[model samples]
Target: MVQRFTISLDAELAATLDGYMVKRGASNRSEAIRDLIRNALTLNHTDKSNNCVAVVSYVYDHHERQLGSRLIKHHHEHHDLAVSTLHVHIDHHHCLEMTVLRGPGEAVRRLAEATLAERGVQFGHVNLIPLKEHGGHHQHDDGANHVHQRPAL
Candidate 1:
C-alpha cells in the first residue's frame, strides 16, 4: 500500500529540487523525493549486523614500502568477506584497487577502513548497500541452489 502526504518547500528549495530531479533523471518530483528519502533512511537506519555488499576503492603508490604485500595479506585474512577485486595501473608509480565485499555490515566496514588506512592509500571511498536475502534458497533446473540478495528497500 502507498500513502500520500503533502509537504511545503520554500521556492528556492523547490527550484533546487527541480534541478536535482533533472540531474538524477527522475520523472517527477515525487519520484525524486522518494529516492532521496529512501537513501536517507537507509543510511540512518542500517544496523551493523545487517548483511551488506560494499565496494571499497582506493589509489595508492605501488612503491610504498611493502604496502602491496600488506594489502594482499589483509584481503586474504578476510577472504570470506571479499567477493572480487579489480586492479588498475594508474601510472608507473600509482595503482587503483577496487574490491567488492559482502558480509555483515560491521565486517565490511572494518575491511574498508583497514584498506584505506594503509600508509600511501589515497582517494579512498566505500559504498555500502545493506541487503536482505530473498526467498532463502531455491534450486534451479540444473540442481544448483543459491540465495538471492537484494538491497533493503
Candidate 2:
C-alpha cells in the first residue's frame, strides 16, 4: 500500500531540505522525506520497545590508564547483551571500538551510558533498533534449516 500527500515548507526550509537530500545521496526529495519520516518514527517506536539491538561506538586514548581493561570488564558485565565487537587502531595513541549489543532496551542503554561515562572515552554513540520477537521455522533456498526467533524493526 502507498499513500500520496502534499506538504508545504517555507522557502528557506525547502532549500535546506534540498541541500540535505543532496548531501545524503537520497537521489530524490520524496525519498529523502520518506527516509526522514521513517527514521523519526523508528526512533520514537524503538524507545518504547522492550528488546532492541544496538550499535555502540566510542573512541578513546589507548594510553589512558587501565581504560582498555575497564572497557573489557564493562562488556563482561553485560556479556549476555553483547553480540560482537570490532576494535580499530586509529593511531598510536587512539583506538575506536564498535560493539553490537542485543537484549532488553533499558539494559542496553544503561551499558552504553556506563561505557560512555568512563574517563577518556569520547565521541560515544549508540543507535538502537527495536526488535520484535517471533517464533517460526524457516528454510532457505539452499536447503538450510533455521528458526526465526528475533526480528528487527
Candidate 3:
C-alpha cells in the first residue's frame, strides 16, 4: 500500500528538481522523487557499519622506500575485507590505485585511511555503497532464493 504524504518544496528546490527530471529523462516528478528517495535510503544504509562495500582510490609514489611493501602488507592484514585492487602507472613517479573492499563500513574506512596516510600517498578517497545484507546463519542452499522482501511503498 502506498501512503501519500505531502512534501512542500520551495520554488528554488522545485525548479532544480524539474531540471533534474528533464536532464535525467525521468517520466515524471514522482519517478524522479522516488529515485532520489531510494538513493538516499541506500546511501544512509551503507554509511553504517556491517553493511558496506567501498572503492578506495589513492595516488602514491611507488618509489617511496618500502611504501609499496607496507601497503601490500596492510591489505594482506585485512585480506578478508578486500575484494580486489586495481593499480595504474599514472606516471614515471606517481601511481594510482583503487582498492575495492567489502566489509563493515568502519573497517573499510580504516583500511583506506591507513593506506592513504602512508608516506608519498595522496588524493585518497573512499566511495562506499550498501549491499544486500547477509547476516543470517543460513547454509549454502543452491536452489533457495534469498531475495529480500522490501516493504511496499
Candidate 4:
C-alpha cells in the first residue's frame, strides 16, 4: 500500500530538487523524492546490532613501512567480518584496496575505521547497506548451491 502526503518547499528548494532530478535522471519529483528519502534514512541508520554488508575502500602508500602487513593483520583479527578484498596498484608508490565486509554494523564500522586510520592510508570511505529484511532462502540438490529471494523495493 502507498500513502500520499503533501509537503511545502520554498522556491529555491524546489528548483534545487528539479535540478537534482535532471542530473540524476529521475523521471519525476516523486521518484527523485523517494530515492532521496531512502538514501537519507539509510544514512541515518544507527542501530549497531543491525546486520549489514559494507564496502571499505582506501588508497595508501604501499611503500610505507609495514603498512601492508598491518592491514593484513587487522583483517585477520576480524576475519569473520571480511568477505573478500580487491587490491590494485594505483602507481609506483600507491595502492588502492577495497574490502567487502559483512557482519554486525558495529563491528563492520570499527574495522573500517581502524583500517582507514592506518598511518599510510590517504583516502578512505565505507559504504554500508543494512540487511533489514531477509527474503526466504533455498538450498539446491547439491546442498552447496543456495539462493536468496530478492528484497522488495
- Which tens-of-lDDT digit does each residue in 1-153 have in candidate 1? 999999999999999999999999999999999989888875553477688888899999999999999999999999999889999999999999999998888888889889999898967988878887556777989999987554442
TM-score of each: 0.80, 0.84, 0.64, 0.80
The positional error of residue 48 in candidate 2, measured at the CA in angstroms, is 5.8
Cα distance off (Å), candidate 2, residue 89: 1.5
Give the per-residue lDDT digits (tens) of candidate 3, residues 50-136: 557778899988889998899899999999888798999999999999999877777777787788888889678767676665443
Q: Give RMSD to native, each candidate.
A: 3.1, 2.2, 5.4, 3.7
CA lDDT, every prediction?
0.87, 0.86, 0.78, 0.88
Off by more than 4 A, model 3: 1-15, 22-25, 30-49, 134-153
Using TM-score, give the best candidate's number.
Answer: 2
* Model 1 steric clash pairs: none
* Superposed Cα deviation of residue 40, candidate 4 (Å): 2.3
lDDT of 4 by residue, 76-140 (tens): 99999988999999999999999998887788888989999999999998887878656666667
User: Candidate 2, residue 153: CA error in Å?
Assistant: 5.0
lDDT by residue (tens digit), candidate 2, 1-153: 999899999999999999999999999989999989877865554354578888999999989999999999998988998888899999999999999998888888888789889999977988877777775787789999988666645
Better of 2 and 3 by lDDT: 2
Quality of model 1 by C-alpha lDDT: 0.87
State in Å the error of residue 150, model 4. 13
Q: Model 2, which residues run further than 4 Å from truth?
A: 44-49
Cα-based lDDT at residue 93, candidate 3:
91
